[model samples]
Target chain A: MLNISNIVLEIFNILMKRIVLMGVIILMVVATVYLWLSNSGFSEGEGPYLGIIALILVFAVFLLIRRIKSWKVGEPQEDELSKKVMVRTAALSYYVSLYLWVFLLYMQDRVTFDKDRLIGIGILGMAIIFALSWVFHHFRGVPND
Target chain B: MTNRIKEFRVKLGLTQEELAKKVNVRRETIVFLEKNKYNPSLRLAFDLAQILNVSVEDLFSFEDEK
Candidate 1:
């Protein structure tokens, strides 16, 4: 039986997922702006905490958004190719992020940036590396075994 | 492994987007399949074969790697 209502509902659900993702991104941007611009009574040494907090918040929100999207769709959105690409991206980013952390640790003593700032940079770098790895795998194709 | 997905799809007058829709996958997946770059799961292979009106063996072939 052709369920027209279900089809319409599925379309609406897909739109809702897009809206949720966009909302999360907008909120992340606004929160980042607020963290940087608002002069609370925090000391200069405490400023890095704001960036780290914003980064964590955004990451958590994105994960939550993915969960919500899959829940709404009644299945994981990732198909076979996407799942493979995701696995490759995760493996690549895991090694790269570890290298980034080690590099940051090595430079902490020599660099003027404090440990807190270095931590923030490490978190941001990890996220960027993961995103870039995904893009690369998605376009370049995960090599077949 | 290599697949005749593009050949069969073309013979059937179906575009990549149409085939992807029939198989419930993204167009990019069909593109990869045609290029023999990404390996599809058994379920996906069965679905694609069914949609193309061909047997699984007729759709995909294993190449000897020496």
Candidate 2:
């Protein structure tokens, strides 16, 4: 006979998976729309709609992520392996973002474009590095420290 | 760190979920421990050893394989 605890655990796992998937889908959609808006806004001259779209998207994505993260907070503390992964990934993300900022600045000497756009790209690159590192560590084995 | 978690678990006739409960960890953690894919903390090792009716040294080993 199945125990009540077993049934509850099963339900919990299914709910967790669904919630995680929903978070992933939200991240993907936010990333796509953010990229598209950035590309089109700069290419076609800035306007009120572009500013409004960017602001709304940023706020919505920020709120959604915060909600999802808060939902995940608390519970079993991190394992030794998980702690190592987080520290390593965060350090890696920092270094990669630093180099990306330098690279973008270096490119500005050869090409003519909006310094504003370059600044935005630099900031976006850092966020991408952090997100990618988190995703990588989630799916991959421990990073080489 | 290779371990005899699966062997001991089988001997006790406990499912992964059941063992996880006794040890207070997720079932995936137990699965990984059994497969030698992840190392357990000292506390977890002790908990598993006790639940499986063995010593920590007997549960896992660091010596070279034969």
Candidate 1, lDDT over the whole model: 0.79
Instruction: For all candidates, state DockQ relative to the true structure.
Output: 0.46, 0.19
> Which DockQ-derived CAPRI band holds candidate 1?
acceptable
**Lowest summed lDDT window (length 10), candidate 2 chain B:** B24-33
Error of 2 at B53 (Å): 1.8
Q: What is the C-alpha RMSD of each candidate to the true structure, in Å?
A: 5.8, 8.8
Q: Per-prediction count of colliding residue pairs?
A: 0, 0
Task: Give the residue spans of candidate 2 off by over 4 A.
Answer: A1-79, A142-145, B64-66
Query: How well does candidate 2 score on lDDT at residue B10?
Result: 94
* lDDT of every predicted structure (CA atoms): 0.79, 0.69
Q: Give per-residue CA lDDT, model 1, range A1-145, as digits (tens).
A: 3699889898778857755786767687777667766756567776665665566566556656765665554444557887789899999999999999989888877878776668778877887788778778888885567
Instruction: Estimate the TM-score of every prediction.
Output: 0.75, 0.57
lDDT of 2 by residue, B1-66 (tens): 678999989998999878876776656567667766677878888989999999999998886556
Pick by lDDT: which candidate is best?
Answer: 1
